[model samples]
Target chain A: MGTVAIYSLFIINKSGGLIYYKDYGSAGRMDTNDSLRLASLWHSMHAISQQLSPTTGCTGIDLLQAHNFDLHCFQSLTGTKFFVVCETGAQNMEILLKTIYELYTEFVLKNPFYEMEMPIRCELFDLNLAQVIQKDRVALLGR
Target chain B: MIGVGKAKQYANVLDKPLGRGRQEVSLSAFAFLFSEVVQYNQTQVDNIAELERRLEDAGYAVGARVLELLCHREKGNRRETRLLGILSFIHSTVWKVLFGKVADSLEKGTEHEDEYMISEKELLVNRFISVPKDMGAFNCGAFVAGIVRGVLDNAGFPAVVTAHFVPIEGQQRPRTTILIKFAEEVIHREARLG
Candidate 1:
């Protein structure tokens, strides 16, 4: 079987809590606990990178490229983190992350039941996420 | 103020950011959130005044941050010092951004030296709010009143702000009046400046 281009997408709250996780690929799906660990560890590393940077006004790491897969992250001004893991050469992921942030503001933040900084449980958000993921797939297939 | 446009079926919505600027940090979200705040506070308070006060306190924080942002972006960080100047700023500049239109009126109280009124046909916070039987005369505009007070106080023009409902004879809904009564010091300073 061929390899899946995208692995997963994650949404993290400001304080490094893993608020959301979704897996798209059949390859190497992580247990929930492991994904949670990955989010907090990545959060610490992102913060440390800011502290370690010699230049002023560091915004922390945005992309991590491994041998086979790449991770792209976008942090909103309000400090929520949205990241996606994809094949190393994936395109338009930054725009995709921004789209996710936009949907988040509309469906999640606006939802009255959504307590601030809590896990995302809104079905509207999940429905929109699935649509975004499908669009990502269609875009990649035409490439 | 939020324009709910048709959801254009772009081949990929992720292709670009939504048109112009409506997608960026929605203000409509705040409307729903504010309603939730009112509902939550309703369970906690017994009297209408107390409930409105709680909602106002919540709006105070929002107003303080809004002042900081508007001053930085809209006024080039220049703070207003005079009474009428600041009142006009809130009436025109701040009102436009916050509620999508300039306030209906900014008038001096005929009977009072320091009292001023900024009236709106319907405040966004109170537009959809239906006061309960027990919440009679509550005026969710109290949140907006707090917001006005926060902006004036932060701008160094301290004032006592409150919300009132004045029903028009023909209109089904009463108008919202944000009453701004400047403190003695502010009035004195205005007089001295004059």
Candidate 2:
């Protein structure tokens, strides 16, 4: 079994705009402007990785590993990319990302007042995301 | 660049967690919210068309979003490119996802070649909605029709979707028939491409 502890979550829209950004723990600190810049930078990097592939078309990157943290990316059919930053060697990352995508669809997209491609500020979405993060508290604290 | 510790204050805001739950919301909450949406629009619109349009507009965003999510959830994330394929996807998969079941029936228009119909015996959105006679020819099913239109339009099939109340024999409530009239260009393209 693999241990997983998520640190932060980022959602980039199809046009490389940062739509939603949330931090789960005190893992890292970056200002709003810096985060936005990093989001777009990562978005372009993802696009470049897909293009640089030897194959004619690439499905983009799904996961990235680093010394202290790991990044798992899930791209929806509509081109929205959800990035989850978890501890190294996180297990069941796929399931967690899938649940997060589902939550975004349900709480954010399904919200009547939410405008498309806007910075997600839905109260329900935040609530559900917090719940998901809380459920993994033990794993997160173990890190 | 400043010390990383200074930036820590920004992350401290979310230190405490909030409410809980996944996708499912309370039915009573949705009922109240939907009722308010209808009531708020009813006060603003002067005619049935405008009211229905408002409701449809509300559902349109939902449909557009659902189409993408549903496509993502499907195996291999394959999208429906054909007319019949998308219609079936919306009728079966989309309906099941949104309403918890497939629609009652999907019928091709006998009179018009460019039309299709999805009939529902009783729509969930309209379950609690009781239309007053004074309002005249108002059907909440227009919201669902709007959603269908949203899904279709987002999938590159531009069409006009309208809801009609067809009374079934011995049924207390009228069945909703969502009539979809495809654009002439869509029909032409389908014929040429198919």
Candidate 3:
């Protein structure tokens, strides 16, 4: 079995604030400010795309492809957005995002100290995220 | 009480560096837990108000905990300073975290300056519940109200939160509204501060 090359992850709040961000594989280092700007820009683009949809309630962009990587976005009902950057053909991106969101709900939201619409720095969330990513990697490697 | 060894292990878990997330609870498990809570309160209470109060008391603890956790998550340990800020936090953040969606709407009481209401078309907790007619004006939403009250009281807002069932035309599910009435001191303080 081949490996799943997951590149990075970003979480944006409703008002287009970058709440959480992480890089898994080296997708090249982006400056913090640049990454934040990218998140907000993507958020606006998502809204614009939704507006362009003929349906009244259009779910925004779910997938975007580039030359080398693919971006998969999962938007929660409350408008919190999760974007995962993966290798061009990474499978089960939706499943991965769902698990990530679940981890987020359990650890970050449940933590008594986490503030809303802010950068997620919860220890438990980070640990579980790593575990999930590693587990997926191992599964992909057929170990 | 837990044994010393077990307590120590728990402490160790807490001491571990951040980002180690806890396991997620299934909705069915939560539903079962909530049902048991209601059943337990039903057996213990003589009146609907008493039952609701017990449920509210149970939810109060959850609310208090959620309030602290959500505050930490959103503001990086800083809490909401104003009444409107905290209300919006509860209306948007708390509802979203708890129900996987934000409440339908938030409205101020036209008759009362110190009152506000957060309304949900269908409350997650009440989804599977069918209130018996004999229960007489009882709503399971009291648990949520208790939670809201717990959050506000802990945040130094000191408000009375109550849950009411408002039936909307052509809707099968009765809408749940959590009404908040701020304490006199809170309003006075907010006025002076603002």
lDDT of each: 0.82, 0.82, 0.84
- lDDT by residue (B1-194, candidate 2, tens digit) is 24576534455666733222153667557765887787788789788789989999999999998887777666346788889999999899899878878999999999999999999987877654556556567687888999999999999999999998898998556888999999998999999997
lDDT for B56 (candidate 1): 83
Chain A TM-score, cand. 2: 0.89
Q: What pairs collide in candidate 1? A: none
> If ranked by lDDT, best first, what sequence of candidates would result?
3, 1, 2
Query: TM-score: which candidate is best?
Result: 3
Model 2 C-alpha lDDT per residue in residues A59-136, reported as the tens digit of each score: 888889998878999999999999988878877778888898988876666454456898887655776778887776
Q: Per-prediction DockQ, in order?
A: 0.05, 0.01, 0.01
- As for model 1, its CA RMSD to the true structure in angstroms is 17.6
* Best DockQ among the predictions, by candidate number: 1
Error of 3 at B64 (Å): 1.1
Q: Per-residue CA lDDT of candidate 3, range A80-140, in tens?
A: 9999988888888899999999887766664433467888876557767889999888877
The candidate 1 chain B region of ten consecutive residues with least summed lDDT is: B16-25
Worst 10 residues of 3 chain A by lDDT: A106-115
What TM-score, to 2 decimals, does candidate 2 have?
0.51
